[model samples]
Target: MQGHGYAQPVKQPPHIAWLVFLRVLFVVIGIFSIGFLTWAMMLRLAIVTRKSLDWGVFVAVLAANILSLVLLATEPGDEIHTAGGNLGITLLLGTLVAAIAYYLAADIRHFHRLHDAFTAHRSMAPAYGYPAAPSPYTATTVPSVPHTPPPMPHTPLSQPPIPAPPQRPAPARIDQVRAELDELSDYLRKQDGHHDGHHEGGR
Candidate 1:
């Protein structure tokens, strides 16, 4: 359902002494909400399901959001929040949130459908939030893991050993580069080189 709209955000006077205060209070809070959502979805596998389709949408939306923020931050004051740019941004965010809401709504619908089907077939009955006792002779099977591990002759069937990866050696070039950097740093120190190495460049 379309919901009631709130007051549209307005760009206040740019050079006011209070502008920094407003940024800390308002702009930072909006950014923080984005960060919170990111953390909430960090461990989710829904995006990786179906051969990484979730990743494709996630990456696309991430790129769009980044581009929007860049344009938002670098545009001239008048254009930053103008009707066209604002519409584009609003549509992008609306799609992102609506997708999530749609998934949740669809899942609820699916659960209801499942409950109904179960009732019709009498395959499973519910007792206070738990499924009622399954038929005694009905074979119970657990969900199969998405990944099938390769067999190891040394591994015991009862307890699978989790092997830690062996530590890798640092690249030879990295050590050489570190030594060269240290020599150059020492030479520069002897010459009292300007921290910026801008001896020839004029301010």
Candidate 2:
């Protein structure tokens, strides 16, 4: 949307003043008969004043003009005059009149406003006005945020392995084991001999 009191200025074309003049002239001439001149001028007006051509008006006028031409070619007699050629001419006239009337009614004030602006301020009128571009130098404030430090990374501690239970030590000397075995053998032999001698004496 345009600002409340500001409008973007544009360059006024040199041909606009004369085109407006010629459009009015063609319209005046078209009152007597619908012709190519009027159609062409209306198209020019649409191109100049609107963002796109006024297709609705263009189609309506074209249809009416074609109807008038067809009716003219047939040359119907007086008996059918009320409903034939007269109707065709009336359709063309009505279409042109309505088109012009609508243009003046709907757009006259806007046109006057543009003309006044152009003359007073040397600014051209936009066909369909545009929203003004925002000023590049305008100041905008950024919101402030509280500072927060990043979290520290986690690391696992190294642990020592558990020790196994101690085993019993073997004997240090082979001579001690041999002495104990010889003593056991001598005791067994003495016991057997004593038994044998007692048995023989009893016999």
Candidate 3:
């Protein structure tokens, strides 16, 4: 085991972006340990290592953020308003970053798969005399018949026709109406006369 001197180089310490990713990630674990551990003073508080303290600080930061938001939302005028607000922002961004990281990790696998598929397709095209790939959704088939039409025909939209307004009822006559009114008045007068005749009959 000692004969082989070719130990793998510590995968070139992560670049700036990677470091940022790590630090951003560091918060997830940092809140639990790194936050406090980063400070030299905390080393003497307990038997905690530098690494462990940072994690606590990071976690404590998250907790503090959560606490501040809760306090701010519940009691707006709380003395720790500034601290709570800052923590709230940190918590939100950190949580978002974490979620994005989760998605990135998940999608990386798909990206790798696509890469492999592309390579495989390219490798096979020369062997089969197949046409070059255009895109994933594009059709690769060549024309079979002399006059092959487009896959789908173009057509204008068939909008529902607006209905015509209904015909209005015929207008009533003014002279006839007046005559009917007169007839009604006469009928009312006869009813009154009948009532009077009844009174006379009773007498």
| Tens digit of per-residue lDDT, candidate 3, span 96-125 | 455344334533443455556666766775
| Residue-wise C-alpha lDDT for candidate 1, range 5-90, written one tens digit per residue | 43332222234344335324433433456432321231132432332555555555556566656555554575546765675566
Q: List the residue pairs that clash in candidate 2.
A: none
lDDT order, best first, reads 2, 3, 1
Compared to the true structure, candidate 2 yields what TM-score?
0.42
Task: Give per-model CA RMSD.
Answer: 45.7, 16.9, 32.3
Candidate 2's C-alpha runs over 4 A off are: 1-9, 13-20, 32-37, 77-82, 103-110, 116-203
Q: Which stretches of candidate 3 lie over 4 Å from their true place?
A: 1-75, 78-94, 129-203
Quick one: ranking by TM-score, best first? 2, 1, 3
True-vs-predicted CA distance for residue 60, candidate 2, Å: 1.6
lDDT of 2 at 36: 29
Judged by lDDT relative to the true structure, which candidate is superior, 1 or 2? 2
Please, what is the whole-model Cα lDDT of each candidate in the order they appear?
0.50, 0.62, 0.51
Maximum-TM-score candidate:
2
Best of the two (1, 3) by TM-score: 1
lDDT of 2 by residue, 1-203 (tens): 96555555644544566646755776676665555234554565566577354655666666777887677557656443555667766666677777676555434544666667667554332323544455878735766688899898888787798798786555655667778788888888888889999999999
